[model samples]
Target chain A: MKTIFFTGKGGVGKSTLSAAAAWQLAESGKRVLAISFDPAHNLGDIFGRTLGHKVTRFSANLDLRETDLDEAAAEYIRRNTSILTEVYSYTKAFNLDRYFKVLRHSPGVEEYAALTALEDLLRTSDDYDVVVIDTPPTGLTLRILALPRISITWVDRLRRIRRDILDKRHTVHSITGTFSEEGQKLAYEEKDDRVMQKLTELFDRYVAVARHLESDANRVAVVFNPDYLSLRESQRILDGLSDLNLGVNVAFNNKYTQGLSEIADSMERELFDGRDAPPPVHRIPWEPYRREKSYEISYDLTQLFAL
Target chain B: MSEHQPNFLIRLWRSLRAFLRGIDQAQRERVVALTAYEARELENMFVLMLLGSFAGMPSPPSFLAVELLPHLEHEIRVLNRRAESSTDALAEIMGTIDADA
Candidate 1:
């Protein structure tokens, strides 16, 4: 399945553009799922429907979902907390529940949850022909996109440390025995250790997501208005993606008007001139009369993006 | 018939064998202690990597680390024990000497 991600600074019309892309792809007879990763979701509003964490049907072949990052973080912590409590019952005395309550609000939890949500959808979305993602603001989106690479490195080092630990355990077992004085079994092999297995699985998942982000099937686009601030932020987004070795497939110059025509030209030049091979810029004209009707905007966007 | 006794050569061989067996047992015990200590140290390092955020080091996300918390009960206890003894330099030195001994 092809995946398209739309990202930029807040208020750059990423949601509207991504929704239009999904609508257009679905209208063309391809099954599509459009997901909004921003906390302030407007994909549902654009489609004139109330969307939530679950997939909601919008059209014959289009499905929409608006992720609640806070809820996603909670769900991730809740699921893992149950497993931890179940296996480490002795830790109850330490009041791990309280510790987990604190962890629910820890830094990076939301970004990790966003990555997990994306990974889950990608894995389970085999029925769809295309998946269009409307990402959060620049900072959050970049963190989510960069997570898989960072996580893969961490998991690799962890696996190596785990192997060293297991080898030491094997040596200890050979000298003594594989069981403690209380008859508790000791794991000296990778296959027998749950932590090692978990680390391996995590490593594979990170690698898969990293490959997905860097694969040819994925297309990333930056959306921005014809203004200085928006242009600067869009450049930052492009630079961040470049650092991750991912290229922008297209750029949408949204809300273009005659008054800013000259500014738009210079901004476009400034945005892509120095790049080795710049992506084609698609200018979306501002429609003052149709501003209230997102359907009309999307209808126009459908034709524009088709080119 | 009078009770027969073991010959002096057989007695000597048995005593020698017992002495060698005692030395082998002591050596095995020493090796076991040393290896176990090494294993514990490695485990501590592994736990640190997983929970490095606690020490202000870059660590894996908490959600990922939480999944492996079940298998880390032993390591957690070891960590706690070390933490309690860490403040006492004399005790740590004594522990090192005792383990070597």
Candidate 2:
């Protein structure tokens, strides 16, 4: 299955383009799932449906979802705390709840939570032919995308230290004869140490997600308007995605203006002024009906996305 | 009365066995102390490396940090003790290296 991520500056209409693409892909009989990773979700507003944390069927071939990061983060914390209590029952002296409260306000919690949510979605992505993601605005989306690699490296270091702890525990068990045969088995078996096992699971999952993202099955579409600010943001998004090895498959120049043709052309030129020209750019002209209550992607716009 | 007063040879052998048992116990105690000390040092190093971010050193990712925090109360307490005794900080670092090696 292929994954398509749409990312750009705020108000650049990435959601609109994402919705149109997913809708069209489904029309062509592909099993598609459209997800909104944006905290301020407008994908549901664009589709005129009340979407929540659950996947809502838009059609037989298309599914829609809007992630609730707060809920997902809370659930993640809860699960982690329970696992900690169960696996390391000897650490009951620690006020884990207090530390969890501190973590709730710590930096990078949101991105980690979002990654947790994304991992959940991608785990079930094999059921579809394509997954369209309407990512959060520029900065946060970039951080979220870079998280998997960062997390894997962090875990690798941690696993090394954990191994040392287990070795010490095994020595203590042998010297003191403190534990039963089963207890010794759990402590001495590197694979049975709960912390090491969890870290390995987390590391492997991140590696899988990262590999899936960098594979040919994934496509990233950089959406931007024909203005200097949007164009500048697009460059950063393109560079960020390339850094992660997720090459930009296409570029969408939405809301094109014919009367200000020179301004648009000059901005586009300056956007890629010092770099190689990007992938095929599709320009969609301004439509009057886009401002209405329920916006519809015209057949012409749908056809453009098909390319 | 005659049964109670075993032979002199039997009494000598019993005393010798008692002496040997005492020496064995003393040696065992020293071995136990050394292993316990090594185990404590290893546990401390593991905690310091994993939870260093809480002590203002950049450690692992926050999610991992939070997950491991419950098991880290002892480490945090040790860190507080080390931080309180700033003069011993250098000695503590040296000690960890010596123990690890």
lDDT of each residue in A1-307, candidate 2, tens digit only = 8888888888888888888888888887889899998888888998889999888998899999999787777777777777666656665667554554455667778889999888888898899988999998789898989999988888887777667766765765666665222232335457766667777888899998898878777888888888888988998887887787667777778888688678777766766666554666777677665554333566343443333
Clashing pairs in 1: none
A47-86, model 1: which lDDT tens digit per residue? 8889998899988999999998889989988887777667
Off by over 4 Å in 1: A87-96, A179-183, A289-307, B1-8, B87-101
- Report the lDDT tens digits of candidate 1 across residue range B1-101: 22334576688999999999999978877676666766776787789879888899878876667667877878877777767776785665556446534
Model 1 chain A: which ten-residue window has the lowest total lDDT?
A298-307
lDDT of 1 at A239: 92
For candidate 2, the TM-score is 0.79
TM-score leader: 1
Q: What is the C-alpha lDDT of each candidate?
A: 0.82, 0.75
Separate DockQ for every predicted complex: 0.62, 0.30
